[model samples]
Target: MLLRIFHVSAASLFWYTAWYDQNFINVPFPNKEYAQYALKGRVTFLTFWCLVLQTIYFTLSVLNDYIGTNADQSKHASLLRTIKDTLFVLAFPVALYVTSAFWGIYAVDKDLIFPDWLAKLVPSWVNHTMHTFILLFIALELVITYRRYPSRAVGYSIVILFNLMYTIWFHCIYYQTGVWVYPIYSVLNWPARVGLQLASTSTALGFYVLGEKLNDFVWTKVHNKMVKSN
Candidate 1:
């Protein structure tokens, strides 16, 4: 109960702040006030969506625990947890991978990607909010609660559909604005773009599998410990 409430509050606060900064304060593009990036940004946007998903997830969980009937609670809880896990599995890798990729590119040619000018506009805390802390929050959720994953067919299908939709979104943004939202995308050839997106999709799927395995491992260990104690 406490965990769910905390999760909801924390996620909501962080995302609201981020949305404000991204839309109002940061304004990455100069002379383009009111030209909010919206859907055409980095993986951070995806992370934001995951945060929104979790806020609802935990909110529902709280209701399920306190307000829902027992039998109904289990059904609702299981479905909500599976959805939360799927969102995390997708958000975690993308956040880490994007952050790592940015640093790598920054180290070599900072101007190419996260140039110093832009970095100043996007402060460290904001960066961590969108990138680093996202993974941490998701990890905390997993540790505090273990939920059984749905079958791979259902889980992977939902995840893959999201990735595919995002891919289409980025392409549409490029067509509309003639600007690649991420600098790294600009450097890639068509084949490379295809390859990278495919790799990202595969990596996200791999993380989902990892989450399932981790859930099983941790819960099994916990069950054994409980049994031994008894």
Candidate 2:
């Protein structure tokens, strides 16, 4: 019951945020040029993409839980479970990376990652919903669920592929539009950007390993407790 509620609420919140962001009309910015960029390019951001991924994950989770309640042994239920697990391979680490990286950079220099104009344009709750609540929800899910971690090779491959695809995507966007999706990119030279990309990807890989280890540690303790009790 708690799981169902959590999944439902999460799905609803993410959907709402996505819709809000897509349709948002910025208040007058002192810099009309940046306002135009923000309006057009906000959706292209990795944070928005990550939010979409998380929304899909929770929606699937809700469906999976519902089906399990109705027909726990059904083939459809099994398939949903499989899809959920596979999607989590991409979702968890990426969400964690976004939250951590955003704040880490934001702390050092808000202008780089999230500028003052962005703060005035986007409501605090919405910003936190995107960056802060996401981590909290995912962390709660991790505590409640016992996912079988994929082998290191398979898991790392998924994370690497996703990171690489996004790297290519932003570069392509910049090449075409002559605009960096995030403010930080504007300050980076090619070599610095390359270093940043490599570091970001490496950090994501580390988070994947962290998730696997944390999952194992949590469930192993649970298993041991059950064994002792029995």
Candidate 3:
């Protein structure tokens, strides 16, 4: 329960900071006053409500899984496979967005985004470099998935649709309120924005296919080693 609450809170906080304050591109340190403002505007209201729905969805899903009926070994295996497939599909674009945003923010000003408390404890470069590397590793992992799920046409289609919807919504809101959620998106002219969106979507889809392969390789190797030891 505590963990769930923490997750919900953290997710809400991040969304609020990103969507409401237009800090999505440059994640702010917790110490910044931008973190404390209450929600405002149509976009802000919509985002907050969507986050609430997401929290409910997560809660119900977890509860359902915890109390759901038992299954035979084969059924369990099939369910696990479905989950792996879904993750493999989703991980690609997620990794790309994460990495791209990391670089975008770092390029602007590395220290501004560091967590306030941690800022004093560690060097800014360390934080910046670590974040960059972690994002890159996630992208690499997404690439690795391709070896396992070589045919992810359905996944690619879903990702493209999702990105298109997101772009439309984001552009509409930005135009309506003259507020930009992400700095990278905000700076671009219409043509550039379109190009970036296309590039981002394509890269993400590619990464998703790659991620599935990497997951299979890692798990298979682990299983083989265990069997040999026994």
Clashes in predicted model 2: 0
Clashing pairs in 2: none
Displacement of residue 37 (Cα, Å) in model 2 is: 11
- Tens-place lDDT per residue, model 3, 91-171, is 445544555656676578865444465466545543433334334433443333222343567777767776676677766
Instruction: Give the TM-score of each candidate.
Output: 0.74, 0.84, 0.49
Candidate with the larger lDDT of 1 and 2: 2
Each model's lDDT = 0.62, 0.78, 0.48
Rank the candidate models, highest lDDT first. 2, 1, 3
Number of the top-ranking candidate, with lDDT as the measure = 2
lDDT of 2 at 146: 57
Per-residue CA lDDT of candidate 1, range 1-230, in tens? 57657666666667575566646554354224215454424333454565455455555545545554223122345554455545555554555555555566768987986567777777777666655665666666666665556688987887788788878876776776777656568899999999999998887788777767776676786656545766
Cα deviation of 89, candidate 1, in Å: 4.8
The best-first sequence of candidates by TM-score reads 2, 1, 3
Clashes of each: 0, 0, 16
After superposing candidate 2, which stretches have Cα over 4 Å from the reference? 25-40, 69-77, 222-230
The lDDT, on a scale of 0 to 1, for candidate 1 is 0.62
lDDT of 3: 0.48
Ten contiguous residues minimizing lDDT sum, candidate 2 = 68-77
